[model samples]
Target: MSSDEVRARVRVVSPRTSAARTRVTSIASEIDDQTRLGEVYIVSLMRSQLRLAVGVLAVLAVTLGGLPLLFHLVPQIGRIELFGVPLPWLLLSVFAFAEIIVLGWLYVRQAEKNEDDFSDLLEGR
Candidate 1:
């Protein structure tokens, strides 16, 4: 083939910096240096998670504590039949137990979401 008819191809690579990479490096450096901003970010994440826990605890206390009081205040409610079982038994075995399971599952999911959010914040995502 003639030089004029021949085609040549070459590959090249250039260094590049992304916002994500830059942010990661900067944040890592700040962490390594123990900067105030990094500490503040961590504290904020902890505060949010702690606040969530406290709120859930408050709700659980109210719900679990109130149930017995409600039953005590309404004695007839305890004797009522539900699905051929006593109301109190059904409440304890089914409703309360289900609530426990649901609350545990919900707490786990929400806590995981909070952790994921914290991770995203750390990664600047």
Candidate 2:
């Protein structure tokens, strides 16, 4: 072959370098870190909310369970009249109102606490 033809036919191939590999590794690590952090934050919030809900449920169960027992033990109290209605009716109405208030308060408080926790997590705290 002629010198010009030989030079023209010569081909150069670039080999994969360590720096490129390191760059890809670093990017993957950063993505993994972000994904793990996000998962941890979600788990923490869910745990906090679950704990709060359990506490609220415990309180509600105690109060609601005691109402029937109280009425049973104190029949006179349940039979007594209040504003032309039986005392039991009044008690039930009041209990229902109180339950609604307590549940609403618990829900609001839990939601706020969860929001705060999530905010803190996002803020890297």
Candidate 3:
């Protein structure tokens, strides 16, 4: 093609024009302003944390509190000894602390996960 014909075939494309985009509100701003949506988010986070706490507490109560009842119902368990330490004493002292520690760790991890999810929502992720 001739230079003039080549020039006619080419057209200018505007860089500024594109598909329509929606404006997004910042969650941080909404929260800072204490908007209704922000309140809802906050309440949701609180509820999740509360639910986690209640669940952990319930588990601890059932397992630890049931120990005494179990020992009472089965007196033989107290007579059994492990390396000179009574079975019930070993369970209450050593195993109980381990259980508590595990439960505490689980509670903390779940609580942190809930907070992380809340933050992700806040960040619009």
Candidate 4:
């Protein structure tokens, strides 16, 4: 309570030092039981998932963004008619959705794989 008393106490160990000694049953157990190593595993898994998501998004953005540039660079493609509509319109309506579907498939596959990999690691496989 007093400055002199507190200085005299001079605790050598942190109060939270005991928390690091808590042991987890296994990865199948509750997350609260996770030790520092387990926490690192979870953090790495999360980072991997985030990286996959960002990579998918970046690819999609580049693919979609390049379309207009392609049209502009090769103006003849814009004049090409498909079912009485400009090629760009057909591409925008058709290819855009197709690209989204493909990207969604890729994302789903990668996400599931990531989850499976994390699960296996946690399970001590």
Candidate 5:
């Protein structure tokens, strides 16, 4: 046989097939199946949400809880009046309520953002 013929006879044939390709699975299906990876994803989201809640609560606690201390530390603050109401009372009522509302809004917005991030993660973005 000639050298070219010998080379052609020894040519390789690849064994690759569709089965060799990586499988694509849906993230929702993985979660529905309660897979380990799914559980990890869920835990991560929960932890982030929990951390956010704790941070907000801490801020609320420090602001609200410190009011009494502030009043005691600065007696003049109690002596001042606003619209015929004691400064402390005004702050505790209107300011506290406004702060609570703002904090609640922040909490909701951040929670939604966290959920969106989690969704993006599941979608492989």
Candidate 6:
């Protein structure tokens, strides 16, 4: 056949959807449903844990933020030396380190707990 005629014939043929497209759409919908369901199952647990974490941080911020003001209001307290540093500075530094350690420990513990729950869900336990 002439190239022009072959091209015209090809153009006349109906376009078909590939099997891959259909399979992909099907899998995408399945994943969407599973994700929605999993969120429903896990969201409350996650929310409560997040709230606890936020509360801890909030308390830490309030306490730490008040320190400088406390020092200013009562200069005598601030003047007291600990390890050759002012009491306020030493307390603030120690509290900052403690906050980091506490947060890290809590995050690891919560992550492990959440992963265990997710594994159980995935295994149909």
What are the per-residue Cα lDDT tens digits for candidate 2 across 1-125? 69989887666433346555554445334445777745665677788888888887887777776778887787778668978998778767886788869798878987897888666645445
The candidates, ranked best first by lDDT, are 5, 3, 4, 1, 2, 6
Question: Where in model 6 is the C-alpha error above 4 Å?
Answer: 1-31, 34-39
What lDDT does each candidate get? 0.77, 0.71, 0.82, 0.81, 0.84, 0.68
Residue pairs clashing in model 3 are: none
lDDT of 3 by residue, 86-122 (tens): 9888888999999999999999999999999987876
**Error in Å for residue 28 of model 3:** 3.8
* Root-mean-square deviation of every model: 7.1, 14.0, 6.6, 10.4, 6.0, 13.4
Compose the digit string of candidate 4's lDDT tens values, residues 12-38: 566555543333235545345686766
Put down candidate 6 lDDT per residue, 1-125, tens digits, no spaces.
69888788884334454554554344334445766644655675577567767876787777777777877788899679888988877777786789778877877787678767755654445
lDDT of 1 by residue, 2-121 (tens): 654544322222224564466676765676678997787778778988988897788878887687888889889977998889888887777888888888888889889988987787
Summing lDDT over every window of 10 consecutive residues in candidate 2, give the lowest-scoring window: 22-31
Question: Over 4 Å off in model 3, which ranges?
Answer: 1-26, 29-36
| RMSD over all Cα atoms, model 2 | 14.0
TM-score of each: 0.69, 0.54, 0.69, 0.64, 0.69, 0.54
User: Which pairs in model 6 have colliding backbones?
Assistant: none
For this target, which candidate reaches the highest lDDT against the unseen true structure? 5
Least accurate 10 contiguous residues by lDDT in model 4: 19-28
Error of 2 at 84 (Å): 5.6
Clashing pairs in 1: none
